[model samples]
Structures are given as structure tokens and as C-alpha cells.
Target chain A: MNINWGFIVSSLPLYEKAAWLTLKLALWGISASLIIGLVCSVVLYYRIKVLERLVRAYIELSRNTPLLIQLFFLYYGFTKIGITMSENTCAIIGLAFLGGSYMAEAFRGGLESVSKAQIESGLSIGLSNMQMIRYVILPQAFSVSIPPLGANCIFLLKETSIVGAIAIPDLMQVTQDLIGIYYQTFEALFMLVVAYMILLLPVSVALTWLERKVRYAEFGN
Target chain B: MLNSGISVLVEGINLQRLLAGLFVTARIALISIVIGSVLGIMLGLIRTSKSKVVRFICRFYLEVFRIIPILVWMFIVYFGVTNMFNIHLSGELVALIIFSLWGAAEMSDIVRGAIESLPKHQIESGRALGLSFWGLYRYILIPQAIRRLLPGAINLSTRMVKTTSLVVMIGVIDVVKVGQQIIERSILKTPTASFWIYGLIFILYFIVCYPLAKLSKILETKWES
Candidate 1:
């Protein structure tokens, strides 16, 4: 039961490759989710009738279910209906689907914090609806939303671990593959944990820094 | 084709097996929630302790859990730890331990936030009344913090339930695993069985989680007013 340093060293190349794939998936998923979230939150904020209801349902459905099942449905079940997608595609879509609802909730919270008086003042200044949303509302909302949005980013990043289940050969998948092949469970898992820490720690730190940077003085200490 | 898929759901005690799997999932979540809450409350109280070292330790624990994905933790425990220690542990046991620890870390933060959010004057007033430290917590802090923390705790419970789906990866025969088994067995006869099976699982999870989430919202709004 000695530590297999050599084995871990040899696996480094494989781990690096898998880590890149994970990073790629997370980046695409997170970017897509941000756009989806922005659109859905705007619809909800504006109280658009039919689209609002549809968005609400979509949000709940996405939020309540585990990302694993969503990936399963997309990767496996969809083939039944002739909607075949690549593992990477399914992984990205699943991550975005889950992340979007969370990000939408975050954005909605930010949008709601824009005071009614602020909106009226924007209108008083002859700001049109789009102009108010663009100039007045968005800046304040973005500031307010930074922390939760950052949190959603990290959550979605960690969630990329499960995309291994779809055979995407992400970090987790690589770790399991190493374990299965080498039967060096401890060494494989240690590398897995290290890989995640390497991936996540800087993001967490940067987000904290960003959250502080965006904190408005008028919001009070 | 749809009829065959539907029949796959109800055929030969399949529904019962899925129910049993759901029960296992619910049991894991419920037990972990209870244990996690109790431990979390204690850790949270310690987190706000006067001692800096204790608070630092609690913070470190929370950060460790936060940074690592739960799936990795599962692998480490279910695979690595047992192998390293040369001891046997069931997948369900490993899942319970990991989930409880993770939940406790999360719940502790919620507890700490709730307790800290109270006005400083509440503590000052309690001390003025000649209350001991424990007396202050019992009589002044905890009662109020419970109401504030309930919505957050409920939300965490829903998260725990949803996350229990991960146990299947560690070889626990949870609801998701049961669905996978059914689909594999019926895939040839009903190629669309995966659709119906996974869709049912999606709904089952929704049924368990959505109400809890809704209740958390309701309490949050009700108490906000």
C-alpha cells in the first residue's frame, strides 16, 4: 500500500489532457448559461406573458433535477427520438441547462434589487425602456449579481466532474480509468483531488476578489 | 412503441423495485439531513466561538469541502479509503458519510450566517440581563436564529436529496441505478425504454425536490414580511 509516485507521474500527461477537456466543457457551458440566464431573467423581469410562463417552467425543471439524469436523457434517451448528440455536446448542453436556471435565479435577484424609485427616476430622465434597462438597471444589477453569478460559475465547474459519466474522459473519468487500469485507487484518487483543487482554487479566489471589487460603497459595509 | 415503453415501466414489479430504490434514496437523504443538521449546528456554534484557532479550523474544513467536487470525495472514500485502510465499507455507507460531511459544511455556514445576522444589540441586551453565555445562546440567539435558518435548511435538504443521485456511481442501487437496470434489461424489446425510464426518474426527483424548494420560497417570503 505504498504511494505509487511513479504511476502518478506517468498519469500526469493523461490527467493534463483530460483537464483541458474539462476546462473546455466548463467554459462553453458557463458562457452559454450566462446568455441563457440573461435572456430568461430579462423575460421574467419584464413580465412577458407566454414566454414568462415557459421560462418559469424551464427554470424549475432545470433547477430541481440532477445534472446526471439530464445528461442521461440527452445522451441516451434522446437517441430514441433520433436526436443523437456527441458526448461533449450532451455534456455541454446538460451543464448549461442546469447552470442556466441557477444563473437566472441569480440575475433575477439582482434585477429585483433595482428599486422602484430608481426605475421611475430613470423614466423621469426620459430614458426609454431599453435605454433604462441598458444604462440604469443593468449596471446596478450586475454589481449586485456578481457574487451569486460567481458562485454559479464555480458550481457549474464542479458539476463538470459528472460529465465523466457520459464517457467524455474528463478529469473524473480519467481518474476512474487510471484506477480501473492500475488498481492503485489511492494514487488515482489523490491525483483526482489535486487536479480539481488545481482547477477550482484559483477560480474561487478570483471570484472572491471580483465580488469585493464590485461591492458598491453605497450598499454599506 | 409508446405503449411498449409505458408497459416497461409497470412490468413485473419494476415499479416496486424503483419504489424500493427511491426509498433507499430518501432514507439516505433523510438520515444525512438529520445528522448533518445536528453536527452543523454544533460546528457553526463553534465557528463563532471566541477562540480564533477553532474558527480557523472550521473555515478550513468548509473550504476543503467547497473546493473539491463531491464526486471525487465519493471516489476517495468509497474506493481509496477502503483500499488504503484495507477495510470494507458499503457504497451506501460511503455515500452517507460523504453527503453528511458535505451537508454539515454547507449547513454550518447557513447557521453561522443566521446567527451573525442578528443585531449586535440583541447580544448586548442579553448580557445586560445577567445571562450566561449558554443562557444567552439558548434564550436569546437560537430561538430567533431557528426561524431565520429554517428556509435555508429546507433548501439544503432539497439539495441533499438531489445529490443523493450521485450514490449510484458508487454502486448504491438508488433510484437512478434502478432505472438504468430496467432500461438495460428492456432496451432491446423497447428501444425507447430509456426515454420513459430516465424521464420517470426526472419526474421522481422533481416530485421530491420541487415541493421542498417551493416551501423554502414560501417560508422565505412569509417570514420576510
Candidate 2:
């Protein structure tokens, strides 16, 4: 098959717009997830009574299902109950619903890794519970959680591809549309792969660098 | 509203078709897992090979799969390759191949981690016993790694099962597609049908994946102790 270099060039602007939209969605989705995750992890860490069970169930349900079905349910299923949302709203909510649980797990791991001895030390020094969590627990947990948080960030970014199913016109949707309209399957897919690589590879590299820096800081101190 | 919703699900073998679609989904995941594990073990062993080129190649393969979403990969194979090569391949076959390749990439990482995490002394002792390289791995390395990797492998299987939902986009009659068709057929008569159908699909996926996840967790805690 002959390559269509010109078609690829012509589509660059369209892809650029779609990539921007994808990045925006990912940004909103990830930010929402971080808030949700932080609250849930704090509850779990403190072993808050009634909320813990609800949080656990939410995490399991979110983690087990696919983002596509979640989007479908949010966009299509909820209309019958008189809860309607725009496709963009549904996409962001779907992403956050899935991502929040993974983030909570990562945060939980970090929280658990802060040793009992450290908490005891804080208590013995007359640090109140809130102060203990703020000064003693959070700093160490944040450092430990950085790597997993970065991984979750990347995972959520890739998951934004499925938001196209709800017609948000992200990168994946644009590529599919191009393929359908132009019958330029090879060129369309080529652009899709390149766009993602451009989008993902730098974040992945930066995260690895950040992780290494954190590890060295831990060791150096 | 409720009666119409129930009828939409029960009408004209709809539930049976949904079940059949689910069967196809399970079949694809099961076959991919079995085949992918075999391939992944090999790739994982190669990843730990002493040769730099072999390891680099393995890493590249894993990264490519990791970076691209599976839906794009499905489209490339299901549409691009078939169109380019002018060969006819069914949607199910493409779904199987893509999922297996993805599964292998993921599983390889798990296997590599397990193998690498083993204590170094075991290999040194095996060498001292005059075991051949292959014999060393067969007798000492793989057996121990299996225990370490089982939970991770089980977790990957659950992920693959959940991901098979994407095959619906490629025109495979997976459970999600079945639900969509049912909703489309009954939308005017029973506008509430989508809620029930999609909810059922969600629950269906939950039923399939939740057990494996629980098993992985159980094994992880058990082994940690």
C-alpha cells in the first residue's frame, strides 16, 4: 500500500485540536479523581466507621468495571431517572469514577507504609491527632505515593480515549472519524499512534525522572 | 415503566443472546490468557537475558503496547491491516489476537518481576550443583517465581477480562454490544430499557471480574504472611 503523506499532513490541525481536548478532559478528570481519592484514603486511613464500608464498595465497583460501560451507563442509562448530563460531563464523571479508586489504593499503600513507630514518636512528642497526620504522616506518605500517583495519572490519560464513545470527540474519536470519511485507515491509525506516543512518552519519562529524584532524596537525607 | 423494562429483557430470546455474547467474551479472554501466558513466560525470560539487545527489544515491545490504548490497536488490526493486505479476517479473530498480544506484554512484566525478585543465592547454589542453564531455570527459577507471580498473573487476567469489553467496538458481539442492540430495539416502547440493560451489563462484568480480583487479593495476603 502506498503511503499518503499529504493526507497525514492535512489532518495535523484536526488531530492537534483533538489532542488538546483529550488533554483538557484528562486534566479535569484527574483533578476530580485526586480530590475524591484524597477524601476516601483519609477515611480509610483513619478507619472511619460507616464511611469505610461505603468507600470499599465504591472502590471495588469502580475498579472492576470498564470505563466504556461506565460511560454508557452514565450517558444513556441515567436519562430514564431524570438525570441527564452532556456527553462531556458524562465523560469526565466516568473517568473520575474509575480513576478515584485506583488513586485511593495508591494513597492507601503510601499511608500504610508510614510505620507505626513514626506515629508513636509523633504522639509522644505531644503532637495532636490532626497535627500528627499533617506533620508526621502526610509528608512521608506523599513522597512514597508519588510513583503510584504518576502511574495513575498516565493510566487515566490513556483512558480518556474511551470518552470518545460518548461523543466528546477526543483524539481517538477524531481518528475514527477521519478513517471513516477519508478511507485513509493507514494514515489515520498512524496519526493516532503518533499522537498518543507524543502525548504519553514525555509524561512517562518525566515521571520516571521524578521517581528517581524522590528515591535519591530519600537516600540522601 | 418497570413492566416494559422487564419485557424488553425477556422478549424474544434477548436474555439468551446476551448470555451468548457473554460466552464469546469469556471465550476470547480465556483463550488469550492461556496463550498469552505461554508467550509471556518466554518473553519475560528473554527480558532477563544477559544480552542487552534482547532485553531492549523486549522492553520496546512492552512499551509500545503500554503507551497505546487497546481500542486503537484493535482498529489498526481489524481495519488497517485487513484493508492494507486485502485479506479477510473476522472481528473475533482480530479481537483474540490483539488481546493475546496485550496480555503477553502485561504478563511478561509480571513474570520478569517475579523472576528478578528471587533471592540470588538459589541460582548460585544451582550452578554449584552443576546444573545446566536451562536446568537451573527449570528446577530453581521458574518454580519459585510461579508462587511469587500467581497473584499478579491473576490480577492481569482480571484486567484482560474487563478489557474484552472493548471488542464490542470492533463489531464483536460481546455482551456490551448485545446490550446496546437490545436497548436500540426497545428504546421507543420502553425508554427505560437502556438503564436496565446497561446496568445488567455492568453487573455482568462485575460478576466476572470481582471473583478473580478477590482471589488475587486473598493469595497476595496469604503469601505475604
Candidate 3:
């Protein structure tokens, strides 16, 4: 029943490196998803009917299935058709695609929150569609989008762990790797839990602060 | 194109294996739902108690599970418990316990939300009518909470079905694990086996999840009205 605190202490440096890698993967993945989400949201917002069906299919497919299967499908399944990519590349792409679907839903909600009156005002002043969206719709949508987007970021952070299954060397991968080598299961797993807490605690706190700030602004604070 | 993948089927043995794998997944998810709902409802009730300490403990349990990945939680229980106590629980047992814990945390939130949204006058009126603590919840509160909880509970059920795929990471021979094995075995016979196998898994998942998701939505809108 004894936990090896000393072993965990000795392994702090390796855990730290893995933590950094996890953060990097989450950052790149979230950024890619946000871009994809924004574009998809824009297409849907404009009522682009033909593309909307394709986008909805992607979103529903990604949302319903397990992310692990998607990662495997891309990582292992692709090589069969003469497409090859590194583990890390495949992880990023998979994470981005998954995150993008959730982000698109958030963006759709945000875009809808931009009041119809504002768009009408832009039209009354002869503002072109692009100009109206740029000057009026986006600013408002950005505020409404912050909270859900932040939640999605946290979700994506936890999802980065799955990349380890594909041998991407992220935080969870490192923990599992350590477990395999050292056989210090409790120590490694405990360290893994603490490492995630360390990363998520501050990010969640900052998100709450950001949400409050945005809400305050909406209230003219 | 599709017929090529079906060519490997011999008296439906592969199909039977896939079905068995799916049965494992379903059994795990269903067991977790029942266990989790009971545990979650208890935790939810505890969270809404007047005692600050009780509420704090329940909230902590809920938040920790909410933030951590189920895969890590699975490892923590499966490996950490085995290592620390030298116990030899099977992977399926470990997965069941971990997923039930996860289900409890999620259900607690739903239960909490449903309870909080109810009118306060009911609780007060029950108190005024001299209902005891247990009587108040049993006679008045729980029935309403159960009604309000149905849509969310169903949604959680669907989510649990999807999330059970994580057990594959722990070497549990669930549907996705079986699919992986099938592809590996058949790879020599057909280079596209992985794709065909995974595509089937996706469809299976979609067939299972899509209807539940649709039901959840319908219930939600129905309840809202």
C-alpha cells in the first residue's frame, strides 16, 4: 500500500517534459480546430445549403463515434491506401478534426447570438455582406463564443491523452511508457493524475475569469 | 466497392465476433448506466443538502471526474489499485468500476441541475405540511426529479456507450479492440481490411448512438414544452 513518493520526485523532470508536449499538442490542435470551425460556421451561417449537408455529416460522424477509433482510422487505416504520416502528425490531425466539430457547434451558437437587428442595420446602411459580417456580426459573435470555446479547449486537453495510444509521446503516453519500463504503476499513475490537475486547474480558472469578463462587458461593465 | 469487403465473410463468423464484441460494449455501458444513475442520484441529493461539508465532498467528486480523462481514470483504478493492493481484478471488472464511477459523476450533475431548476415552493410546502426529510424527497421531490432527469439520463447513456471504447486502451476486448484484431488478421488478405473493418465499427456505433441521441433530443424538447 506504500506509494513511492521518492520515485515520483525523481521522475518529475520527465513528467514535466511530457506536460509541455501535451500543452503543445493541445494548443496546435485547438488552433487548427478553431480555424476549421470558424470556416464551417461561416458556411452554415450564410445558409450555404450544398456545403452545409457535408459539414453536418462530418460533425455528426465525429461527434457520435469514439475519438480513439477516428485516430486509429487515420493513423493505421491511411497507410493502406499508400498514405503515410507520422504518429504525431496523425494525432494532431485527428484531434483537430474532432475538436473542429465541437467548435463548429459552439461557433454556430455564437453566430446565431448576433442579433438580427444588427445585421438589418448593416444592410440598411448599404453595408455589403462581407463588410457587414466583418464589422458587425463577428465582433458580437466572438463574445458569445468565448465560453463554449473555452469548454471545448478543456475537452480537447483531456483528449490529447488518447494520442499516447498512437505513440505520440504526449503526457499520457509518457506515463504509460514509464509504467511499462519501471513497473511503478501507482507512482506513475499518481504522477499522471497530478500532472493533469496541474495543467487543467489554471486553465479552467482563467476560462472562468474570461467568461465573467465577457459577461461583464455585455452588461456594460 | 462494398462487395469486396463482404467477400471475406464465411458463414458470418466474422460478423458473429463483431456482434459479440458489441455485446461486451453494450453490457459494460448498460451496467455502468444503472450503477451510475443510482450512485449519481445519491451524490446529487447529497450535493443539494444543507450541510456545506457534505455538499463540498459531492461537488469535489463530480468536478475531479469531470476534468480527468476516463482513460486515465481507468488506468488509475486498473493498474494503481492492482499494483498497490496486489489484487488481480480482470480488465472488464476494472473497466466496469471506472465507468460506473464516471457515470455517477455525470449523472450527479444532471440530477443537480434538474433539482435546482424545480420550484422552491414545493420543498417549502412539503416542510410546512410536516413532511420529514426522507418523506419530503420520497413523496414530493424524487418523482419530479426523475421526470426531469429522463432526457439527460438518456443522453448520458449514449455518451457512456461511445466512451466505453476507451476500455480498448486497457486491453479490454471490446468492439473497437475486436475490430483492430480483425484488421490485423485480415491485412494480408486485403490491404483495405482496416478501412472496411473501421467503417463497419463506425456504422455500428452510429446505428446505436444516433437513435438514442435522437430520442434524447425529442425528450428534451418534449419536456421543455
Winning model by DockQ = 1
Q: Score the docking of each candidate (DockQ).
A: 0.87, 0.82, 0.62
Q: What would you estimate as the lDDT of candidate 3?
A: 0.86
Model 2, residue A25: distance off in Å is 0.8
After superposition on all CA atoms, how large is the RMSD of candidate 3?
2.9
Q: lDDT per residue, candidate 3, A1-221, as tens digits?
A: 77788999999999999999899988999999999998889888888989999998888887788788888888877776678899878888998888998899899988998877888989999999889878787777877899999999999999888888788777788888889999988889889999999999899999999988877334222
Model 1: what TM-score? 0.97
RMSD of each predicted structure = 1.4, 1.7, 2.9
| Segments of candidate 1 deviating more than 4 angstroms | A128-131, A217-221
Residues A30-124, candidate 1: write the lDDT tens digits.
99999999999989998999999999999999989999989999999898888999999999999999999999999999999888888898999
Best by lDDT: 1
What is the DockQ (computed on Cα atoms) for candidate 3?
0.62
**Candidate 3 displacement at residue A195 in angstroms:** 1.7
Residue A62 C-alpha lDDT in model 2 = 98
Name the top TM-score candidate. Answer: 1
| Pairs of colliding residues, candidate 3 | none
Worst 10 residues of 1 chain B by lDDT: B1-10
Each candidate's chain A: what TM-score? 0.95, 0.94, 0.91
- lDDT (10s digit) by residue, model 2, range A98-179: 9999999999998988888888989999999899988888878877899999999999999998888888888888988998
DockQ, prediction 1: 0.87
